[model samples]
Target: MTVCAIEMTTTAPFTIAADGSYAARLAGDGEALYAERWTLAGPEPYAVPLPLAQPEEADTELLPLADGRVLIHRRVAERHAFALLYPTGAAAGPRTGELPLGAVCAEEGGDVRVRLLPPSPDGRDAFALAVTGAGTTVWRVAGGAFGPEQVARIPGRCSGGVWLDRVGRLLALDHELDGTTKAVAVDLGRGGEVSPLLQITEASDDRLLLADPDSGLLLIRSDAPGEPRLGWGVLGSSLPVRFPECLRLGDAHPFAVQPGQALMPETSGVALRLPDGRIGLWRPADRQVFRFGAPAGWLGGTGLWSAQGRLHLPYATPEVPCGIVGMSLPPAPPPPVRLDPAPPTPTRPIPLQQAPL
Candidate 1:
């Protein structure tokens, strides 16, 4: 069995699309960043740029659309700002207008957070998480012709949220209630009823990083191992395996995974930045860690997990502008383990509090 890989050199970082068949890059020079969208279905990847323009600074957050468009978000004062970027090449070079997401969480101040959750499994709409004074709200990003629709909301403080399904029908939110923290599943189509999703034991702190609704596979980060480390478990099949805490030391974010497939042999896992300024990969299933043999002086931050279970990392050396290495992986068989649900351990009685950010 052969797994295809894609590598390219550029000046900007990239985020892969949900299905792993596409990648989007925002190449910036000083004040401006251009978008480069690559189609990966064929042997050769064809790329195109949006109307060259500068929106936010280097820290601009990006979300790739199902139809090959790009979404950009930045915080402007107290409001969450968003703009829908249309690739000019998709319509023969004439760039379409950027759709205004307007101000989300405008009334909420102090790091009003907004995040791009996993897109719909069918490659249709994308979802965004916005924290406002009212509560945590999830908005569906349909397209240019339509405004974002609020599909779900968590009544109280919610953090460490992740999609529980690829179709985005279900979402898991980390909730702190009665002085303890655990994750709860929210049915967007329903009344957002909160149900226990992940809780190893009330004695430990845990949160879901990525979860596959079908396989019940979830990549979790928990303090159960005595320190913050990687833990993975199947919903109802096997016990979770926890890795050493050092695997996540100096890590910028949790491991990457496909929106639906969570773990795959050929896909990339979490990227780690060592104390010596080196980077590495975390394979929880293998219980081993390996660093990328990237070119010297490669900057690291976050990466994308493809549907094929491959991790796509963005790096830049002093000599090269920007590029990506799609770490290849042979198709791995499904994990044989499962986690049996157990009654949650009891925590001291206290007022329900929001999980810390």
Candidate 2:
């Protein structure tokens, strides 16, 4: 069945909060720009258009913070700038920052470790790597400051890293010299020491994409043959649970892994599109599969997640223009009620006399 569309003039990447609220980047024609916050249960989401300082020339990314705030990262000039949006009424200006090793990267697990680098300056770009557990530079920006940290060089370039918990432990995907990839868990608080977990292949350029790290499970993508496949592995386990089939890479870009499922409110897991064009949710503990119908005209270029116990799917439906769709599962049936016969009542009632009479 077709669902209602959440209208948007222009939509960018969004992060779903634990409460099912969302903060997304909304871009309209002209320099009209801002981050909008929406909740599925509310009548309408709150849209806060950014103040028109100078027109932003490029797109931006909205990263949700743990404190109910958001970090807006906009790429300007040759470097990236960031802004902190407070839950109250304060907004920090765009701050200049540098990426480690001069590569395009993303923060994993809140602000745990960074992963992936854009094309290298010398033209040999590394797709995967992470800050080693023994590596002291695991944190360059501390106390809520934005900056790059230097560290000892490791054997392979890191394609992705994920923080498994709030304690700073991380799982990273390393692209080894022999073209294969391996998953390693590094204790960022300790020195950058590597603990071997799973080895996918032995080629130097094998790409390992870290998706979401929740509790102790890590969602990863193996792109050795250029076709992406989803895999789930634990921190110390050698065998990885590979999804039966490959997943659609969607415009050749990495799909963000949302930590929890909105539809299945009782469980926690990762959701993504499989190669067969089906959006699948895999619960890491039991590997239970939850499949949803892909809306018509969705070229796999959509974002899928459960927010506020409702499914938030943003896709291009053929019947309608591009927009975000929110869906909630039907509530469970009420217990069967037992009917009882009504008791008979007197046909008429006697009237009372006044004491004065």
Most accurate candidate by lDDT = 1
Which runs of model 1 end up more than 4 angstroms from their true locations? 1-13, 52-54, 76-78, 90-96, 108-111, 143-146, 238-254, 258-287, 295-357
Q: Give the TM-score (vs. native) of candidate 1.
A: 0.71
Q: What is the lDDT of residue 296 in candidate 2?
A: 49
Report the lDDT tens digits of candidate 1 across residue range 156-229. Answer: 66787676555656677777666566777777768666677766666666777775554455666677656666
Model 1 worst lDDT window (10 residues): 345-354
lDDT of 2 at 340: 32
User: lDDT of each structure?
Assistant: 0.57, 0.41
* Cα lDDT tens digits for candidate 2, 109-226: 2222442222111111112233443321333221223343433235554545544443333434353444455655454445555665444544313233543333234455555434
